[model samples]
Target: MSASLAPECNEVKERYDSCFLKWYSEKFLRGTARSDECDPLFKQYEQCLSKALKAKGIDNMLKEAREDNRENDAEHMRPKR
Candidate 1:
């Protein structure tokens, strides 16, 4: 019943999170480019973010994710350690 649904929902959330992390990592490497070669990965990342937004009940999560991505990019662009 409700308990079963809870675990199933959690699995979905975890999957979405993992997908987002993978996408973000790749996107960070891709930087500001919009090349067709990066399209598939971007689309996958969008799909995962969308799923995560739905599960988390937050409509603006995508924007936040993008912002976070930008910050991460900036951090990486800095001089290496």
Candidate 2:
């Protein structure tokens, strides 16, 4: 649940986390399915995380890991000859 590469953006991340908890309990658990309640906070958190990831040089690493995961998935799904 933590984001922004750890210590950075902790406050905004916590704010988003709180909103998520409220939304989860009030909407999701209540079977309302309302999704927009925490979107703004998530956007803010994501924006901050994007910057932090770029600053910490982790974005490219994550992209490469995702690519590797995709390759692994493809390999696992290969049809038998």
Candidate 3:
């Protein structure tokens, strides 16, 4: 997998990635995943990533991007002319 945006978060991200892969392949694809098996790992990874994004002033940009995409989602769902 690719490294995280922040070098400091890379380790946590890797741990999360590994857990996600195992859960996805072993339980998710098999239709046996009862709950989010990677939630804790994901939370840790998200915390690290969020800190990195805030440090680099990218959190706002990402938030804006998400808002922009949300606004466009409805438009995109309509039949094309």
Best by lDDT: 3
Q: How accurate locally, in lDDT, is each candidate? A: 0.58, 0.83, 0.90
In the range 15-49, model 1's lDDT, one tens digit per residue, is 55665566557765668435445455556555655
Clash pairs detected, candidate 1: none
**Model 1 compared with the native: what TM-score?**
0.31
What is candidate 2's local distance difference test score?
0.83
lDDT at 30 for candidate 1?
A: 66
Off by over 4 Å in 2: 1-8, 70-81
Question: TM-score of each candidate?
Answer: 0.31, 0.68, 0.81
List the candidates ranked by TM-score, beginning with the highest: 3, 2, 1
lDDT of 2 by residue, 1-81 (tens): 654455777888999998889888888988997557889988988888898788889999999899879978888798878
Please write out the lDDT profile of model 3 over residues 40-62, one tens digit for every residue: 98998898889888889998999
Can you list the residue pairs that collide in candidate 2?
A: none
lDDT of 2 at 70: 94
